[model samples]
Target chain A: MMKILLLLISFPVFAQDFTGCGEYKFKGILKYDEKAPLKMSYLVREGTGSQMTFSLVNKSDVITLAPFIDKPSQFKAKIVKLMDGTKGELRTPMEIGLRFPDPMSASDTGIEKIKSVKCQ
Target chain B: MKATKPFVLPIFLLCLSFSVGHAAEGSKQFYFLGGGGEPEGETTIFDGEVKRVGSFINSSGWNSTVSFNGGHSKTEDLIKSKMGKAKNAGTFSEKNYNDLMNEIIQKLEKGELKSGDQLLISIDTHGAKRSAGKDAEKTHRVALAHSTATELNNLSGARTVDLDKLEKIINLAAEKNVKLGILDFSCYSGNLLNLHNDKVCLISASGPEQYSYATTAVSLGFFTFSYPITFGSKFFDNMKKGKSLEELFIDSRTTGDTPDFPMINTKEGLAINEMMYRFLTPYLNYNYSSTNNFSAGYVRRGDKFEEQVCRMESSHSDFLKLLKQMEEAAAVANESGREEFQNLREALEEYRKYQRGYEETLRQKFDVEKEIKDIFKKQFPNDQKAWEAYAPLDFLSLNLDSSITYYEGLAERDKGKKYFSGMWDSTVAQLKKQKEISEYVKANLSQNGLDKLKAQDEAFAKSGVTYKLSSRISAEAKKVYEALYNKNKSAESNPCRDFVL
Candidate 1:
């Protein structure tokens, strides 16, 4: 009964649309720990004409993404956490992946997933 | 017909003697005004200047006439009261402006005035470079008050006066024995110095390659406003004492720490005597608390940025070349050169740091340009021409920022021996000041009820700001970038060529 009350308290605090079910996987030039992997959640917000904004939160950095052109679902974000940062966008499907055109770095490719949650 | 021919000969001979006879008399002053800005929205600064100059000539009891192409009725009345009827027009069209100039030339050609009588011709307008034929150099033309670029394109019916036409007029005046003194208050006015002869004297606001700034803040050109301020009550008094126009030009100090180098070019062997006028005190009568230092600041910053970038590139190349030479010498030296070789290697390592910094600058430039273009595209999605119009200014902003960042890094790397940090600091400050003025001008345009597109078009059309950025700044950028490329090419082509071993 006490654990159920704790669950209710934490449920209301989760970011809007961030149900804590999403799992992001690293790929391409960027190396990561295979054992732990990467995880995150995103919330969509209103944007300027034909654009949609997404906020991605993680422990190290919080990235804000929006479409550069008319491709709304393929949201772009600038990664400032790397060597002086880079600009790129992510394409989300069954498993999401990252792409960028920066000449300095080739480490931007990645993937994402959302796992179903079970409650008893 | 025979009788008429003999009479014409006698009449010509008599007029020739009459023209020669008056060569020893005093000078005569005539005023000709061309284009000033809109009269309703702003104070008629040029017309006011005409009134003041007319008042001075009248107060000094000189025989002169003022004929302005367009002036307010009130200013025309003032001129009439002081001198005589000014050639007043409600709107100074190109046809009307050319007509006014023709009238003056005809009067001079017809011997309306005696020889040695000086005609002080002052023109206040915006000047532009008119591209010439493949074999010819580009010449400048001054836009008339109501003239538009559309009119400029219709060359057969263009309103502006080219240097060739102006030179022909000056030649005619000289042939008629009338001394011509020109006070051209416009950008690239110094090009008028080309007409200099024993019979002509010229003074301009800026060199041919430079810009003369105007600010809505002051509502008058800095050079134009400074004219009377520096001359004081001595304006007419000095002229009476026979101070050549060059002296007068030098005396009229530019106001408020102007970076523009106002120039005066006189004919060879002109009289160089210093004559004191009756009036010594100066009064900046129409003082504006705020001033427009935009053009001067912009030119200075652009120049400094180019110099800094070129210097950094040159120094890096020279250092590398020096390293290669030292290595070559060490290869031929005995064991005693070991210590020197160690020192040379250390120096080479230090120079490599600078080389990497310069390389980083190139990369940063690419990044900044990409970011700026993205921002501009996002802002003006539909207008490609606006993108072109604004691209130079945006490019300059990022170029300057990159330069500042590089300089900061260099200063930190060199410890106490910061080579170019001082100049970079001042350049950055000037850039900031110009950005503020640009924003203010942009805001003013919007408030004046011009929609964004219309504002961009009209501002570029009327203000001469189009020429200010696109050509001049881009040319400077190209110069620096080319210098860097050349340095890299030379370094790569002859890598260690001097290392004999």
Candidate 2:
């Protein structure tokens, strides 16, 4: 029983998916109905296995994401409302698109993708 | 129907058996009515109402205080001279108004506003209706005094006591287990109903499009002058008989004219009936003394239904222990004492009644919680996303999408499509709250970690796709809820026995 438990612990779980670790600049429109996008910056913290945290600046929002057991390389982040200050409203539909920094390329920051990788 | 099978009966039973207890001896009723501008405007009406309502409640044997800008006459001259603004503005300086509201909140936080108290606040002042845009309307607010620049450039600054600040004050009162009743006698005051919550009753002097009427004849607004004058005596009579605020509103008498149709939102049919009665009745007790009564249980705001449930259980357990101790003391006192025995007997009686009221209110709240769960189960029987999103519906204020989603589902199920559709339409008018919550989260969640996370998620997304993440988010929410509710249970086991009488 002990050996089996050890084996199970050692086994690589195929379920865990993308790991979007490290700081990234995230931008998204607060209101989906409206065309204007509110640009926000975030610090991304990726944990050992499946958890990832995103701390948004300016808006002072923090979000955590978890990978689905069935969906490979795809993580889910909660739907949150963002404020549209220009309209004097805090309820804007928010979506975050993250990009890593790249000093060499003026337009090309590191890929806009969450670095998808297998569980260790 | 099949979807409701698993949760329907169990949730109903849970609600039926649910009751939470709050034990606090000092219940102080606070009344803050400020019509910033008095002489130039019909703020004298505010002054009259203050005296009428204050004296009326006091005469009914309740400890009450009335705070307003009675001395604003001197301050007004100083502010106008300092800013070179209009002399007839009649409102207090913005700083003074903010300071008054802040003082009230500070006292409440300091336990001046205890559990089982009533907070009746009315603000009668000049108002302004500012549009965020063409699409957004009806965020009406009380206009305070203004700076010279603000007055010259834009008069919107006068609308300082906006919906968000008012909502914060009401939420604080609710947190203290205090019943909240607000009356706004300003232009477009009907929009003030956006502050409505459980245990809260709001009355606005005018509808969204109308202006509150102030007649020179009475030196006051019609609603302010009419409500207490026409119904003050009867309202107090019914109140003594344990009538709830909603009942008082429904049975209230009105005279003269209904030019500015008053709007009220009680969130009726919830546990508020018992909550308000319990909070207000103590004021009616002729023997009521702030220093004598002893409080035994605890009241803390919980973030989730499960946490609230556990807290209720613990509180009830503590209440039972207190009762047992009192009974033993009463038995010993017959042989050994007189005053202690009488005090014990009185404490037991008052506590039992208060405990019963608390439990009833808790059960009532659970009924609503159960209904929300039932609606979720019936609407999205197999959908995980819907279940997770709606789980928080029982805890926090319902966001627009969730409300519309629930109502639409109800419309689908019920044979009376007309009624449900109308309900859905009325909810659509309240989409402005979505904005209010968004701003509140941004301002309040800057410090706490978990709260910040929850606040961020509350920011409504552009579409339904974002809600898919709720399936994962629900687990974290449940853990946080459990931690919050269980944090104080360790101290509950040892009964509180230090009160002098």
Candidate 3:
């Protein structure tokens, strides 16, 4: 039992040393379409879990997180609707939140939630 | 019915004939043969004492060991394959050299060359002004004799061979109406640029006097580091545009820090030259293509891509042309009392803003991803989690209330572990304090005051501190306290979450 515990503790250290985890920086335009360009903001956090969120802002729209989680860190929250009903998604290690695009851009789109647990 | 069917058959036949002819016209055959030689030599300075300078010339000589050896084999293989069933030349001996030159002359005289027949030759060997004694002089003397500007010009039927032999070859290719290019991987290869002509293009390895050899592997020759293998695909694709030889060379050499390699066309009244120039200038003017478009003879380095793209755009005279047009239009509008100035200004401003915002969004995203990766390094020092998550993350919620809470929980979970505890505690404490300060300022400081305080605090906290308290209290207590403080402070007077949970 002691040996097993020691192995478990040492596993992360060994794994980290081998992993080439360093920052990668790049710059390129986010093209959604020919027109209707939305200024996009992205934040991705990974630790015990992984979470990704995108915030898109434009004239006449102010969007914030739509779904509230009891534990935001354990999961990710995606802002699905702004003042106008533009859609987006928030992804976490075990769950996913999706929002629908405006009817003008994409009609018949709906919000989707997917649940799965991933161990890193 | 029979007459109508006959007419339809003729129409179909005509269309088929046209399509087949088009396909044949579009097809191109490109052949490339490149060689580089950097002979290690000892130079003796005839000052009272003979100072013998040893073998190393430049980085190109030392770094190109692997590339040179590999390039030689590859070139030999390619040439042999092309010359299959023809007389095989055993080596680069005098007899073989004469045979090869004869073969080229025979091909030219036979009119076997077509408009799209591409011939690429690259030679990156040392050129000696004076012959050295015996052994060292033999191979190096070829540049002075058979490969000299005058010899090549005489062979190619050029009036004057003042330019480098490489330049003369390209000019001959033009006269023969064949697409020709040469990648010269030698020091002073750029000398060919002075002899630019419509039919010829030269891509040099480096600036004049700068050694163009390799430090890592056996240096192949000039243009070995930058040519056909690296940017061959793009070059072939560009050839389909029917660009002049000059245009093609300019575009090829515009990618790196080497001096602008010139492309020249001597043929007058040729539309191909102008077309090639117009098509290739846009690509060559920038160090990087806007679309990560790789060209023949070039590789993209990630660090320099964006800056190169920006520099290319800023250097373009087209933008200035547009500005001049705008100004003229504005002046006319003002004279006519149309007040279109506001409209024009607004339009340009809006366009500029949109471009700026688009670039900013990409920059921010890149920064965020980088930050997240960095944090992962901190959280899972030796773990692959950070690397794996690099491409997937949006922005790191460094300033988010939830982020604070999450880290707090992680700290609690890490209780009883003193390994890196000091580092973790200090980071958490500093972050907590920062949040507290931000909140305090938000409630009390004016915008200007807040900015000043931020600058001062950031300067003071840049290196950060590792708080080592000499107390019996568990490390978890300090972490828990910091987390709670930060969470509450970021929430802006909101009640703290139930810590017991």
TM-score of chain B of each: 0.45, 0.37, 0.30
Give the alpha carbon lDDT tens digit for every residue of B56-75 in model 1: 56554444444453435644
Every model: iRMSD: 31.3, 30.0, 28.8
The weakest ten consecutive residues by lDDT in model 2 chain B span: B492-501
Q: Which ten residues in a row have the lowest lDDT in candidate 1 chain B?
A: B276-285
The Cα local distance difference test for each model comes to 0.37, 0.36, 0.30
Scored by TM-score, the top model is 1
True interface contacts reproduced, per candidate: 0.00, 0.00, 0.00
Q: In model 1, which runs have C-alpha deviations exceeding 4 angstroms?
A: A1-120, B1-27, B39-42, B60-63, B69-91, B130-139, B147-159, B213-243, B253-256, B267-308, B311-363, B367-501
**Measured with DockQ on alpha carbons, how good is candidate 3?**
0.01
For residue A97, model 3's alpha carbon misses the true position, in angstroms, by 77
Query: Ten consecutive residues with minimal summed lDDT in candidate 3 chain B?
Result: B44-53
Query: Candidate 2, residues A77-117: lDDT per residue as tens digits?
Result: 32132223212211211222222211111111111222232
TM-score of chain B for predicted candidate 3: 0.30
> DockQ, per-model, please?
0.01, 0.03, 0.01
lDDT of 3 by residue, A7-41 (tens): 00000000111011121121111212212233223
**Each model's backbone clash number:** 1, 8, 46
> What TM-score does structure 2 among the candidates reach?
0.32
Query: Candidate 2: misplaced stretches above 4 Å?
Result: A1-120, B1-26, B38-47, B57-65, B70-92, B107-112, B134-139, B145-159, B215-244, B267-501
